[model samples]
Target: MIDLKTQYAGLQLKSPIIVGSSGLTRNPSKSKELEEAGAGAIVLKSLFEEQIEIQANQISDPNDYNPEAEEYLRLYMKQNHLQDYLDLIKRTKEVCTVPVIASINCYKSDAWTEFAAEMEKAGADALELNLFFLSTDLTHNGPLIRDLYIDVIKRVRQTIKIPFTVKMGRNVGNVTALAYQLQANGADGFVLFNRYFQPDINLKTIELIPGSIFSRPEELYDTLRWIAILSGKIPHVSIAGSTGVHNWEGVAKCLIMGASAVEMCSAIYQKGAGVITESLEGLSKWMEEQNFHNIAQFKGMLDASKLPNPTIYERHQFMKYYSNR
Candidate 1:
């Protein structure tokens, strides 16, 4: 049998295809189906900071804020939402054999950090912190923003013992510096590029609307490049690719380029859970053709530094190649 086994953030996953945090993952039934369909792990939908704050705000008004009423109402809503999440984790753990990863989209070090401990208590095998700020403040610099990310990971790390992964955005000016800082402070894994929400203008209605949530196949190259670059640099941190991995070929490319695992959402949304099974099984067959028995045999094989000419990964537009062709 071909060994598809891989490790992500200290947890052993049977495959490399992790279902990234999304609404679909919140359902224990869907989670179990993904597992049965050959998924490596499942990341439950993230509990956003905004999600908690909005619920709290709707129930209690700050202008007429009553300490007793606010406390009661806030706790009531938070508990209800949090209870559903925790229950999902517990129920999913019971139903599925694969690792159940809890997710949180936190922009700061605040009350939500406390929830990490509760997540651990609820039987989450790992925690993925999708940490990023809007950065609307003009005063922010690389170091300050980097420090905030480091602090967020550090605070949460203190709250729970389960291995944690930081899902970062592409805009972080110095990914190397940010990853190093988080690794130093106790991040066990880093998922390159969390897909953020984008806005679009409605030409007909003159209103701002949400952009396409699904990732295009072309977006895979940029993510693959970073994974290849960072894998060679930081071998200690378990690296997973996110946003743009859509098929088995994409999965194979990521693994060969140095990712231990890959997270997929848009593909799942469009293709259904069968994509996980097909991707994993197809990868195994391809590995067989390549005469490799395990993921370790080919993982990182295509790291830029491993290639004879490292410039292939760094070079962008080639007027030379275009002119020649």
Candidate 2:
């Protein structure tokens, strides 16, 4: 039998198929379904810091006539039900047998540390901080943003002893430096590249339209490249590949590139929870065909340091191709 058991952020997972934070995980029934379907772990729907701050503002505002109140309410509606999230973890623990990870998106470092502690008390097997900052201010630089992340990690680490991972974006100047720093600061693992939802232009009305298109198969290429480059570079840091992982082949590719596990949001949104079983089956079939007994043998097989051409991952081929040709 193929051993699907693997380690994610020090948590022993039965499989590497993690149901990423999304609306599906927001529902208790759906979360239970995913657990029953053999998901390694479930990241509860993320509680957005922006949403919390907006709610706090609305609740404290004296004027009821503010037009933005409506927008605030709409944003508030998208927030995860913390009580429900906790109950799901408790109940899933009782019936289902897998790790239930709680996810939180924090804007301020100190403000959300208490909440992280609360999640630990709520019986979350681990916590995944969906740390994000849109550093648009000219006054703030990369070091400042990195410092914010460090502060947040430090605060959360102090409050909660549960093993925690961080889901980060690729906007940083030096990913390797940041990854190593986070590892040193007590982060158990890193989920590479949280795809931000960018607003699009509506030419007809000249309005900014909001929509996050589900990731396509091709989007996995970029994530694969980074995972391959940074896999074994960071000390005691596990890597999870997120975004554009729509199928089992993508999961296999991530493992080969040194990702400890794979997280999926768009695929479940498109294919439903049943996709979990399909993905695992596909992975098991591939392993059998390849004559591999376990995930360890194949994981990180194509990482940059192990590859014949390590520099290929570092240099951009687009400019090189045009200039040389």
Q: Model 1 misses residue 164 by how many Å?
A: 0.5
Error of 2 at 35 (Å): 1.7
Q: How many residue pairs clash per model?
A: 0, 0
The TM-score leader among the candidates is 1
Runs of candidate 2 exceeding 4 Å displacement: 60-85, 316-325
In candidate 1, which residue ranges exceed 4 Å CA deviation?
60-65, 315-325
Best-performing candidate as measured by lDDT = 1
Q: Can you write out model 2's per-residue Cα lDDT over 66-167, one digit (the tens) per residue?
A: 767756664464344455556766776666568888889877776688778778887889999988787899999989988988888878888899999989
Give the RMSD in angstroms, all C-alphas superposed, for model 1: 1.9
Across 1-325, the per-residue lDDT of candidate 1 in tens digits comes to 7999998889999999999999878789989998888889999999888888788778734657678877888889988888888998999999999999999998878777888999999999999998867686889987888888878888988889999999989988878778888998999999988988889999999999999988987899889988888887776768899889999999999988899999999999999999888898789899999999999999999886698876667663354457568
Q: Candidate 2 clashing pairs?
A: none
For every model shown, what is its TM-score relative to the native structure?
0.94, 0.89
In candidate 2 the C-alpha lDDT for residue 66 amounts to 73
Candidate 2 overall lDDT versus native: 0.83
